[model samples]
Target: MSQILLIMASVRPSRVADQLADWIHARNTLGLSIETVDLRDWPLPMDDEPHQPKQEGFDGYRSEHTRNWSRKVDSAAGFIFLLPQYNWGYPAALKNALDHLYSEWQGKPVVITSYGAGGGGKAADQIAQVCQGLHLEPVPTRPALPLKAAERTDAGRLVDPAAAFAAQAADMQAALGELAAALHSA
Candidate 1:
């Protein structure tokens, strides 16, 4: 099975990143095995590894949390990051979590689903560049699902969910599955 790790980059109690991820993952992924990693579950502080880990083998981090995170990344065939734009960028939690690992991310194809009032394009763009530096393959077809800033959610129901946005969610999820499947073969 092609295992894909779905990461939700939000720790805030009311943030919508995980909700968005669930919304996306609920669709058909053509039988792909899906797992989840939410920052809220693995709250990481600033990168505090005692030493940088080995690049190829992925060994050396002193922090158990970081080691666990690396193991999670190493286990997945690919990834989907639900990065919610905060103040025109991704949350520091996501950055810190990413900084904890190095070689584990290399060559992995990541599907970045960025959402925000301003389309979360900037955050996605920034992370793509970061991923490049880490030698990870951010998927060529980046899915930027921009949500309205003032969009409301009451007990999980989006107050004004648009048909276009819903369609985008479905389309992006489908494309992401296809890309992940192809990457898994490579």
Candidate 2:
């Protein structure tokens, strides 16, 4: 069975990406094993690698962090990026994570799902461009969770991710189905 990684791409202390990820994991009916990987736990330094990821290639990574990250990404059959939109784009942490490894992401199936005030369409589209450069195959049904003012608290925290994004549940499932089909074809 292929395992699908639900990558929490936001590292903010008050971010609700985790809540969304947990909800997605709990609601999984696709039969594929899903694992949550929070970028906060990884804490990879910005541009720490001595050489470009492409230059290093697989097995040529000099840093243990890169090697471990490489292994984790290599092990996944597909990825569902639980991204948070920041300034009309995805978080830097997510971009840094993607930049740390090269071949590990090549030709892999990925579903870019974003959440923000405006549905995160811009952010998702931006990341899709990056995915192209990395040779990661992205499905067309990118699910965007649009957060409304009423859905958030005074502190800008989510009231409840599951309830907030309930309407988009079908869209998410469709994205997951697309990812499953992509993985199967791969």
Candidate 3:
């Protein structure tokens, strides 16, 4: 079975990033298992670990937190990053998460769903570049969920109760399927 790791980049409970992740997970009909890892919940510090990840062995790491994070990234066959534009770029927390690991991210498929002022499409572009540097293949057909269409609930969950966002979700899922197929074929 294909496993997808959804990285929730926004700390705000009601932010659009998590909502977009939920949308993808809920609408996934491809039998792919989706796992969401919230940046707020992980709370990994800046990449201050003395030893590099490759030297630590795939399963061995100094900190338990790093070990767990690395394992999650390693297990995923593909990734979906729910990014909210901050300062016209990806958030520091998400960058930190990416920096903490090396081999886990290499040669994996990645897709971005961004929301912010102006829909955060630019931030998605920037993130795609970063993924390229990591040797992760970023799918070309990313769907931007603009802020206007997304609503935040009082309890801090983003809700897109309309059918419009479904198209974007479907596009992402389809791209993921293509990436999964390529990975399995390789």
Candidate 4:
């Protein structure tokens, strides 16, 4: 089975990022194994390591936390980043996480979902550039879920969810399908 890694960059508990991640995990139909990793839970100190990740490798990590983090990134097949636009860019934590691993991200397929005013267009673009630099294929059909239209019910579920973000979701899923096909063909 293909593995899809969901990286939740938002730290806010009530944020819609988690909801959107869960929604994607539930809707994926291609026997893709889903794993959600919240950056908040694995709080690492500023990158103060003596050597760079590419040079020292995961084994040379002085911190056990960093080592564990590297392992998770190394094991994933593809990634879906849940990014919220912060001043027209992706969060520092998300960038830091990406910087922590080099070899793991090479040639991986990455799909991004951004939420904010204007549907996180700025953040999505910024992240796409970073993904390209990392040698990861950033899918063109990125899904942007604007903050204005996301509805949260009293029960804590997103209301009118399917129709609310169907267009973007469908686009993302289609991109994932294409990525999967490419991986299989290779």
User: Which candidate number would show the highest TM-score if scored against the true structure?
Assistant: 2
When sorted by TM-score, best at the front, the candidate numbers are 2, 4, 1, 3
- Candidate 1 regions exceeding 4 Å error are 56-58, 149-151, 154-157, 160-164
RMSD of each: 2.5, 1.8, 2.6, 2.3
For each candidate in the order shown, give its overall lDDT on alpha carbons: 0.74, 0.86, 0.77, 0.80
Which candidate ranks first by lDDT, i.e. highest? 2
Candidate 1's C-alpha lDDT?
Answer: 0.74
lDDT tens digits by residue: candidate 3, 52-163:
6663344457888898888888889888898988878978889899989888899888877787757788899999989988889887777676666655678655555346
TM-score: which is higher, 1 or 3?
A: 1
Cα error of candidate 2 at position 1, Å: 1.2
Error of 4 at 12 (Å): 2.4
Instruction: Count the clashes in each prediction.
Output: 0, 0, 2, 0
Q: Per-residue lDDT for 143 in model 2?
A: 84
Cα error of candidate 2 at position 59, Å = 3.3
Indicate the TM-score of model 4: 0.88
Candidate 3 residue spans exceeding 4 A from truth: 55-60, 151-161, 164-167
Candidate 1, run of 10 with poorest lDDT: 155-164
Scored against the true structure, residue 113 in model 3 reaches a CA lDDT of: 79
Task: State which candidate, 1 or 4, has the greater lDDT.
Answer: 4
C-alpha lDDT of residue 2 in model 1: 71
Off by over 4 Å in 4: 55-59, 153-157
